[model samples]
Every structure is written in C-alpha cells, then in structure tokens.
Target: MAQGSGGNVIAAICNLFFPGLGQLVQGRIIAALIFAIIVVGGYALWWLVIPAIIAGVFHLWSIIDAARFKASD
Candidate 1:
C-alpha cells in the first residue's frame, strides 16, 4: 500500500539530509554507524578534497540504499 512505501520515501529523504539517519530509523545500527563514520570521518580532514568527494558518493549511496530497503515481515 501507499503507506508502506511512504515510510521508505521518508527514509530516503532522511538519508539525503544525513547519510546514516535513515539506517538508524530502520534499526540498522551497524550499517548506520559505518556510514556515519565514513561520512563524518571523511569530513574530519576538510582540507582534502578527495575524501569530501568520497563522502558525497557515500551520501548518495545511502539515499538510494535506504529507498530500496524493504523490511522483512
């Protein structure tokens, strides 16, 4: 139904704002933590442009991955 898909949409939007937030919402603690670390840690050295680009990739990947996730019943 539309309601179930709505949740996934919201999760994707959440991920758009913060890489790991959607995973956290879905109770994917480890995955969320890893994403958070990758994104945040990447920015830790803001002077390096490469890490920032990699972080951007991770951010987009998070959004797509969250949208595609289907919770098992």
Candidate 2:
C-alpha cells in the first residue's frame, strides 16, 4: 500500500484502537511487536505519570507511523 491510501487509513484507525494493531495489519510484525511492547508495558505502569505520558506519545506515534507507511516498490 502507498502512503495516504485507504489501507493506511484503515491501519491508522486500527492503531487508534490498539497501538500495534495497525502495524500488524500492514504485515510489519517487528514494528507491531515493538509498538505493542512499549505501549502495553507503559500502560501497565500507568500509575507512574511519566510512563503513562510516554505511552500516550508512543500511541500517537504508532497511529501516525501506520498512516504514513509506504510499501516498498
């Protein structure tokens, strides 16, 4: 899929619900795992304000990353 395509839009929506899900949908297993681990781990430690903020940042990053992803030609 190209960047800014329908697939990217769907992936972005997926990431909106779950950070790593969009990467997974785009067939990027490593990115999906990394995003999932960081986001989920941070959320698990949400009692700490810093981690929670970090999680939120990562979550938005994940969404944007998925939205902007371009498949290699």
lDDT (CA) per prediction:
0.82, 0.95
Clashing pairs in 1: none
lDDT of the structure predicted as candidate 1: 0.82
lDDT per residue (tens digit) for residues 19-52 in model 2: 9999999999999999999999999999998998
Q: Judged by lDDT, which candidate is best?
A: 2
lDDT, residue 3, model 2: 92
Cα lDDT for residue 40, candidate 2: 93
Instruction: For candidate 2, give the lDDT of residue 29.
Output: 98
6-72: candidate 1 lDDT, tens digit per residue: 8778878898888899888888889888888999888786689999889888888888878888766
